[model samples]
Target chain A: MKINFPHRQFAHCESGVTANLLNYHGFPCSEAMAFGIGGGLFFAYVPFVKINFLPLTTYRIGPGSIFAKATRRLGIKVIKKKFGSPESAENELDRLLEAGRPVGAQTGVFWLPFFPPAYRFHFNGHNLVVIGKEGSDYLISDPIFEETVRCPAADLRKARFAKGALAPKGRIYYIEKMPVHFNLPKAIESGIRDVCRVMLKVPLPLLGVRGIRLLARQLAKWPDRFGEKQSLLHLGHVIRMQEEIGTGGAGFRFIYAAFLQEAAGVLENDRLIDLSRRCTAVGDLWRDFALLASRVCKGRAVGQDSFDHLAALLSSCAVHEEALFEDLRSALVR
Target chain B: MKKNDVPQHSGLLSGNREVNYAVDVDGRYILESSVGWEAKNIALRQAWEAIADELTVVLAEIKDGKKSALAYHMVKNQMDPALLSQYSGVARWRIKRHLKPAVFAGLRPADVVPYAELFGISVDELRFVPEELISPLAGLDQVEADNS
Candidate 1:
């Protein structure tokens, strides 16, 4: 017996899953609302950490943070579990399905058979909902896909237990309780404030706006230091992380812009609308950056001057974001 | 991006195969499966090509007995030693030891089982590098060129 959970395709996984789960529990949450309330938008470029041998570039906060923060803000109680063995994980998932609970799970993308061949990679932080089990196949709602899909039990097991960076370890989470009413304005304000602190107030040079500037500095030197092929790969990785892998459109700048537009309506604040437009412009700049970077990746070298131009573009984005978030923080305080 | 500004393909072969998430004309968030999505796919394919090229070299090293088949599979699967260690529940040092051709040849079935399972291959298959591993991107270049 499966709970008739609605499957809606979304841009990003965690925020999408959080929105679907919250809606299933009677919250009627939108994806943007969930993302905003969770304070999901973020950026960090840590050269020391690597994913697939390239420097770490992330468009959103760490995996699972959105769901955790959103639920906490909205007063939704959730039960999260990680298993030591695949057998126990499968058993628990089956048990949950039998009890009519649509469980949210974190699994590696590489082992999931339903994903398009090109999209399948060894990304362990991918999130989906296991809505039902029929014999040896489990029905899954992967937010990135166009529709619901089914995965064989064995493949599901492999994906859930895939080893690597950000391994899920057979993690499953589900809402245990939902509040009758949530204070949307308070949660939105809190989310806005927190993001402002992260983007504008964070002191570390390796994070927030400073991190973007650092990435820019390093990007400018990539062509000279690593030569053409390696430099292109580095540039390609940055664009791939920004556009392709669960970015929710334009490195999450568009999503954050959408959130700001929604917040403007909710809080009846005109300033947020202005910030939303500015954020959208930043998203456009990121798109332009990706287009240029993709051209470089395809062996169409635009010369060394192109690298400097791209770095300047990134720096401008950082500056605009820093100012926008600062304004948001002060507006929320008022 | 605006709806009008969104890239659209027009020609004899005109259909959007890739899906993208963007805002629609109604100011509602929607998924637009458009030809523009292929741009990102091309980028992704290039990244994979680089990895496949590395794996090709690693496979040759394995075949020449310079490195073990474990090294070939690890590179083919886009995994590093630390990641393989986590997946197999094997200690990093032991995994490193198993990367030597001599050490890998002498490994017991029990020792080889976890790596095989992680790679979704049999023990024998894990011990021998496959032919496809040598030139993994053989036809990929043609497919990409055709797409462009």
Candidate 2:
């Protein structure tokens, strides 16, 4: 019989094994048997031997971005400073697995419908695990695990949830592989890919930039019904305006430019909707404000770095657009 | 164990011993050979390509007129076509039909102004706008500002 040890900070595979064995039959989360069994396993282990799935200890959450996503994965990759290409992440995964540690990572990338449309813009926090793999399918363990799953690495890269930010950024951890003789044979599967991603249900009006961006263009005008705190309401309108152009997907620039004309007028109103037609340039509102604020005030402020980072990403996107158009025009001529 | 000495199940199969022995050997051979599988994923890429092209044509038709502005809600995203149509004013059939094609063809149908309106901006200005920036959100410069 396998010897059982007391729970410790770092759990060994033996402990995990015993936990799995005793809990395997059918153990409830809050039961005395469950706690005594699982917690006892957690407490009596030495460092580097025990593997614990503690949410706060390993994972982190923050703003999402193309560059940040790449940097996060860099934390675990061997022999690399920058997680440069998709191929590089693959190489990193291979190296890590061959070395016997199973890694968990979250990419800013996301799938559409993972959240309501209002929560789509720049909202972060997605967790996923790299549960080894075979062939074209990467075995994954997600929080909403219903069954063990295998998905094409390429498809995972392309998921909208990755939000085009396809590298680990949110959360990360790893478990060292057991000795060969004692290693557990992988079972048929344990979890499903139908992830139950957590969604924070906040009031619609309280939702920041994205909410406002949608309302401005879709509503024809921002609603005055919310009333008072017009600047806050105006801020909501501005966010809606931004959403029209934010890095949503291809062919969105034209929509942003067109709607900017309408959203600006909304900003100038008593309720920010009456003069919605006259507003032609929405960038005028923040570009000067941002530049002047940066020059005048030398302190860090909330949304300051976010504003700059997003602006830079947006600019890069613009340059990419120019290149595509040039290529298209040249193609047409040829 | 050697080629001709099997006797345990032969008593049960006395009526047809030769056939049962042949069947057991064949089943074992098949089970061993099936340990690995052949790759057949070409079908998936082909399906995507066919679906994408058809979708682009459908999207072009849907955003042909006034509804072109609401194209963002209707095209390329993973949302249900019917859901998008509720907001986009284009019919759901058009969205389902055209979405993949628009994405595959490198067109953002949701951001595209009607072909008639494309002439409003100078070709140079059109050149200035990124295809990506053509979404209903960012395509309109003024709107992006407010949202930012």
Candidate 3:
């Protein structure tokens, strides 16, 4: 609940979205974005189809697979840093790991935060990405999956991962560009990289738009001297500077509800009712019914329910019969 | 129903002198002979409505292909084995013991097909009845299905 932004670098909508989307498509765990997007996709049962989640594993990247392809497809670079407590040996490996990178580069530095007692669920071990900086505060997209939050760079003064004499007192986790393959599926690569596409937060354009623009601006400030596309940063700045526009962003809320209904329904069809039960973002009953219909389409055994049976379930939620049937019919096409 | 008067056995209890049997398919015997004998006809004609009734149901189910006919071993698997033993008038183990001989006595090797025709269950599932006893089970099924 305590959201804090950590210092980090840039993010792109098109590449990041497409890459991670592709990576998560076949993954057993649903895909979620740190900010902007909160919901992840999952298929409960594949009547005939099957997919392996191994391609998404961090340890398996190589030349020909989708993992390697994502790095090559997008110009995203990766860096890794390991942390050690200074009270131990005099090994120079820890210093060498943290020394070389340019200080203000628009780089996503992966670092281990000071293990907070409040955040320790399973041992204090964690992995996080620092994507931007606001004054002295580090803007981060933590993969903690709770909420996108920020914390002070000075907080890292106690940071075990930093390099110093007592630096060995803390630990440093491996940092890298969120492996692009870890971001999007290949199909939607060009359209929405860098921007986090969360179905749950789809209606909140402010959060979605602000999060991405800040990332773009941060990336633009990177010292790596590539003038490839300056227009991207300008656009990011324009949007990031805006006030809470359009009816306190209520239209965004409507769209968010529609998406939630669809997403929750998607979750239900997969027998993932627990996820729907946990969701508090959306308020639409038709979406819930659609989730049920989606389950049947995904080949779950809902027992002898025909199209008429489907329409009857939808009717309970006050959805029009024709529209319900149409949605049910369409869910099957996938 | 025609009944057979009790046969006389020497070791009898004080009050009861008769213990009647109702045998329709041929007759029931309490013989101690070690050797088998050829056919010798002794007529005590009685109609067994049981055998006639069961055969009627089995024949109908078979004709319509609702029941896939199988060899004794496979049929034994589907039916309750205890029932089969009771119908055959044999000890339970003897039912398993004589199964091959029973199947071979009535049917040819080419007659039984595997999964395509009948489901292969264990021999325990079979309900055995001598040709005469099958009727009561058939009536039971009809009664139960009707009630359901």
Q: Which candidate leads in lDDT?
A: 1
Q: Name the DockQ score for candidate 1.
A: 0.39
**Per-residue lDDT over A1-334 for candidate 1, one digit per residue giving the tens place of the 0 to 100 score:** 4569998877788888999988888888778888899999888998888777888888788888889989998888889999989899999999999999999999988898776555667888899999998879999887776678899999999999987678788999999988888898989888887787787677888788888999999999998999988888899889878877467658888878888888999999989888887888888888888887877778665668889988999999898888888777777755
Candidate 2: tens digits of C-alpha lDDT, residues B52-146: 44445435554453223224332333234443453334566655544443332444534434211322333233223223323322222332233
C-alpha lDDT values of all predictions: 0.81, 0.28, 0.27
TM-score of chain B of 1: 0.75
lDDT string, candidate 3, A1-334, tens digits = 1123222211221112222333323222211121112221110111122111001101011111222234334444433233343333113322322342211111112122322211111111123434344555654444322234465654432233422111223332222343425433332222112112321134532233222232333333322332322222221112211101110011122222222233334333432222222221221232333334334333352333333444454233222322332333233333
Candidate 3: chain B TM-score equals 0.23
Poorest stretch of ten by lDDT in candidate 3 chain A: A51-60
Residue-level lDDT of model 2, residues A106-189, one tens digit each, is 443233222222223222234344556677666654322223446666654433123222224223334322222311111100
Q: Name the lDDT of candidate 1.
A: 0.81
- Cα error, residue A42 of model 1, in Å, equals 0.4
